[model samples]
Target: MNHALKTYQTWLNDSAVDEETKNELRGIADQPNEIEERFYKDLEFGTGGLRGVIGAGTNRMNRYSVARTTQGLADYLKKDGQDPAPSVVIAYDSRNQSPEFALEAALVCAGNGIKAYVFESLRPTPELSFFVRRLQASAGVVITASHNPPEYNGYKVYDGTGCQLVPELAEKVTARIREISSFGQVHKLEQTEAEQKKLLVWLGSNRDQEYIRAVASVSPRSEQMKSLAPQLKIIYTPLHGSGNRPVRDALDALGFTQVSVVSEQEHPDPGFSTVASPNPEEKDAFAMAIRMAEKEGADLIIGTDPDCDRMGAVVRGPDGKFEVLTGNQSGALMIHYLLSSLKETGALPDNGAVVKTIVTSEMGAAIADRYGVQTLNTLTGFKYIGELMTRFERDGSFRFLFGYEESYGYLAGNYARDKDAVLASALICEAAAYYKGQGKSLYDVLQELYRDYGYFKEALISRTFKGKDGVDKIHSIMEDWRSRPPHDVDGTRVVRALDYLEGIEGLRRENVMKFVLEDGSWFCLRPSGTEPKIKIYLAVRKTSNKEADQALKQISEAILTRID
Candidate 1:
């Protein structure tokens, strides 16, 4: 009759509970710490949807948690009424249990009399956004963890306008999720029953074609590509995720004849057999692609993440060695090539603008400004950039020419509200070809950019903290830093601080804090929303590459000391 055992008994007796779930719950009933961690609180729904480890606990991501979230969403939609229920689109990536989770969500929506369009198989996250807008669906859900590890999965919600729910709307969804007392109270219909009731609709190749056509139209250099396409030797890898077919189709349509796909990674693999992590932002993820590039003697190498929202590239340097470009360098090259080509062809818009996150390197801003284009900085997520694009399209302020984040996400057109690595793969190869025609390498352009913009180097350091205790430790670390802010770093005086959680400019109240030193070095600290880690970002501007590297090392050691 103890509290924990009683809760378990209630779950076992509930008609909605399955034998498998009951068995799993039985194993944790006697573990006090596990029970406390699982049932102490509910998973939070923030600006992004729910993301956590996949397990049988309430705090973890599971069918029950997904059902409750969908029911909450259904309730919210019911309140914002029309004669018929609102429509929703669901998509999944190649992750363990992703398809099951997507189907579970679709069933819940169908049970609530909502029209649900579920993809036949795994697809990229950005395509879900595009499908929502193209189908004019009221909302969308993508089951993915972006670049998180295999054990983790996530659910992201998007509005009718194809952007992630903003803060105010997310708060409402959170409130509704909180109102649900237990997972057994959430209702669901069998797939067959839902389909027979005309509530579930399966989408296949027709939608894929529509998305591909939209991606093709975003090409600003199609005509130039026709002339140089055959000569471009490019390599592409999806990293065993979802980008394989779409990226290949986009390139072949642009008349690129010599494009090669990394054979070992072309098929979707939930285990991501070829790399340690499927994230394109990490150099280790490109090991397979690099080997393939060397074998093919390719001029450039490109890889997309598991969800295909981010992209990374490697190019042959002037010294005949291949080097992976940082996110900032890749983004700068894309903007430089896209704008320069359009301006040359008299296609550049008079009010062109580029959007980037505040933590992203300023090299992009410098490049855009050189071309008479404005660069706007937003908060850390692509949703903010998408929101900005929607606003610009609503009011005639400026045309959204391009938008990117330093984590390898980039977008050139408004067809997709999220970053489309499939589109990026096509454009990146075209840019490489355009530069190759001028007898220059992408590396050459990057060096020139650094020479002109000063040697600006940036690095990201992430520290992982897991389990319930880790959360408290992370909080304590941040609180201690707030109490005794670093006045100096690496023998340099801190000149200014920007805290974003406070929403202030100089002394903002945000969870994020940025410190600028006397030598123009800067560092920032923030907790990651989608993962169990704290990230520190450092940037230093110096006159030479060696000096910048030295400054970066010093600053990194200083930050580590403070953390320790």
Candidate 2:
């Protein structure tokens, strides 16, 4: 029998496995394919930690897997030992089984004699990042799959600095995870026992106000907002996740009295019944919000993902139709708004700088250059950005003004190390209200930006591969392109190529490739760390929006034809 088959048989015989799981396994006994899919391998504890379909198997996300991963983390924390008893902070989003998994993780920590500070109910992922340092805990864990579908759930670890564990730190945890032999070896404690021992502590609404206050403090145009907010109509949607309360309270605190919530998506529904995917980046996620905006004649619309870390915006364009702004467009608008506002007040720091990923658009950088502010580029992942922010605070080499990526994720103030939709929501609305007071819309300002900086266009494409065979195909695709790279497509010359697998440009080694064209257009290819998908990013600049859009389409098709 295969290894997967043997693992299935062992689960059937093991008394430690739960009765419900055993029954589920028995249902699949007649189907070898289902057995192989469920037991192919332990759900990988990658750099971002574990995420998988919620089910019963070594390769699935269940109570056993959650506890097993938590054991490794507990062992790692206890290895060096602490002068004081070590503690951990835990938070979860409004996903199915999120609350249960969170409690199980807390029990594992309690069983290991570590104190656990768990939120009383669901909260945004960034709040966990904030309280990790606020509570002075040893580490943090948040249960969420972010914007993924309802059937999926995840576990991500954060270091003491309130930043997600980067590659180096994550590898140590992964090594320890592989040492545990079986579910029976992991530890657990009863809730009453944990509470009696004072190992489990519950957090409540007072902390929510502190987080909301911190986010509201990032509003740069609060003075103008107080006077103009009542006149500016805004629409927001949480998409059936955790953003409903805090996002509303942040806006309410900022004096935005004219705000309206999309009633259909304002509450927590674990099924996410209203939207096909809970991601705010997709236009379909804004369907209900748009109707509300149109009826209310709102000036702007904003939505955040289930975890409330990523934000998406929609505004009226020159043609008077509602248009969804791409990540690059929204990011560029924010950069210009922030720097210009600072310049107007003469508070723009001389050593101020912004950080973006390698795949983000250049328009933001171009705007920063005009104001004498510097911009730094990092490899993909907000964790890199967060890690850089921590370094800046430690050394004070440069003032960290902002950090963002082209995935609708942005962070403004240093109060939190992760991308925060609550903070971004406040800033974006303030930007709109600030400009609206000046007798111009956000779309009008975007047009002015295009006139000053050349028109820039960007596009992103993702191809997913599933199951065991899909993994082999992805590896083959990466090796093929690495060995034989493209030089020219339809007479376009490739001026330079940056292969990051060799640790290019003071960055760590990563399996990513970028080809820069002679006309300043470029495209990048990289495999995602959290999901089984490869992403392609493309960008170009031209004299006009039409020309830039055409070139981007042509180049994207030429590249896709070769890969697909």
Candidate 3:
């Protein structure tokens, strides 16, 4: 029998597997393709943990997989021998089966004699990071797919530092997960029994209130906000996720009385019924908020992803139409606002530092330079940024002013060692209010920044590959790019190229290639760590927006041609 076929038969015969799971397997027995897809391999417990379509299979995110992954983590925690008793904080976003998965993880932890502190309901990913440190837990886990399609869900693990597990730690966890022979070996505790034993603790409003207070402290100019906020009409949509309460709570606590929530998307809906995707970066995700903004004549429209860790904004442009600001544009705006505001009030510290991913726009560094603030670049993930913050905290070398990634994730305070949408929401709205006080719009301020610091624009193209064959194709493309890099982009000479796989510029090794063009334009190609997508990041600097945009278009075409 085929390997997948044998695995399928075993599942059907295994008494430990649930009746519903066996029935689902039985229904797909005749379908060879379904069996192959589901049993080809276990849904990988990647560095971040498991993420896959939710269903009954080894290749999916079922209860068994969740329990198995938790058991692996528990074993690792015990072996590492954390001080005193080992405990973990657990949180979930408002995705289908998110709450259930969180509970399953908690019960599994309890079975291993590890205390589990779980949120009573859905919360943002960043707060999970905050609670990890606040509660002084040994580790943390959050159940969320983070703006992926409705069918997908994920589990992310964080260290006691409140940051995602770094490469070394993740590798150890992965090795432990592989040691678990079967789902049947993973133990679980009944919820009631766990609670009775005090192995399960529920986090409630006290945690929420503390988190909101921390978010409020991220604002650079609260005094100015107090005066201008009431006049600033803002439209915010949670996109059917966890942002509805905390995002609003932060704003309201900061005295932003004119904020309006998009009614259709204000509540948690697992299907994300109103939008095509829950991602804030997509324009379609802002449709309802845009309509609400137009009707209410709101000055700004902001949307957060399902996990509330990424934020996207729509501002009225010079053409009197609401335009979606790319992640680069929004990050640049926030950086400029935060730095300039602090400088004006003499609150800017000399040791302040700004951090961004290698793929993020150079405009942020330029803005930071104007303020004499240091800039640091990390590899692709926000965890790298968080790691830097922790280092700065330990040695008292540099104070982290802000950290951001081009994928709509931003963080301003050390309160949470992760990208925080609640904090970002507070700062963005406050920045809008500050600009409004000066009789200007956020878009207007962005244009001013462009004019002062040469028009810097960025574009990202993500090409997704599916299945085993597609994975092979993605690796082939990366290998080809690394082996033979292009000499130019749109006829501009390539001045330099960096292969991160070889550990260039004091950065860690990874499978990424970056090329810098003679005219100050550049592009980088890297495969997504969590998903099977190859992302191409293009950036250009010119004296005018039109020229910069045109340069990006030309360069994008040239690169895509070569890839194809």
Q: How many backbone clashes does candidate 2 have?
A: 0
| Residue 187 C-alpha lDDT in model 2 | 85
Least well predicted 10-residue stretch by lDDT in candidate 1: 504-513
Number of backbone collisions per candidate, in order? Answer: 6, 0, 0
Q: What is the C-alpha lDDT profile of model 3 across 278-332, one tens digit per residue?
A: 9999999998888889998999999999999999999998878899999888999
The lowest-lDDT stretch of 10 consecutive residues in candidate 3 is 41-50
Every candidate's lDDT = 0.84, 0.88, 0.90
Ranking by lDDT: 3, 2, 1
Q: Candidate 1 residues 51-127, lDDT tens each?
A: 88888766788888889899888777777534265999999999889999999999999988898999999998889
* Model 2 per-residue lDDT tens digits across residues 1-564: 999999999888877889999999999999999999999898865535688889988888898889989998898888843525789999999999999999999999999999999999999988899999889899999998888889999998888888888888787777778888777888889999999999999999888988988888777677777897777789999998888888889888888888899999999888999999999889999999999998988999999998899999999987777899888888999999988888987879998889999999999999999999999999888889999899889999778888889999899888888888888888888889888988988899998999899999999999898888878877888888789888886568989888999999888999899999989999998887778888899999999989998999999999888879
Q: What is model 3's C-alpha RMSD?
A: 1.3
- Decide which is better by lDDT, 1 or 3: 3
- What's each prediction's TM-score? 0.95, 0.98, 0.98
Assess the local accuracy of residue 131 in candidate 3 as a C-alpha lDDT between 0 and 100: 89
Off by over 4 Å in 2: 45-48, 80-84
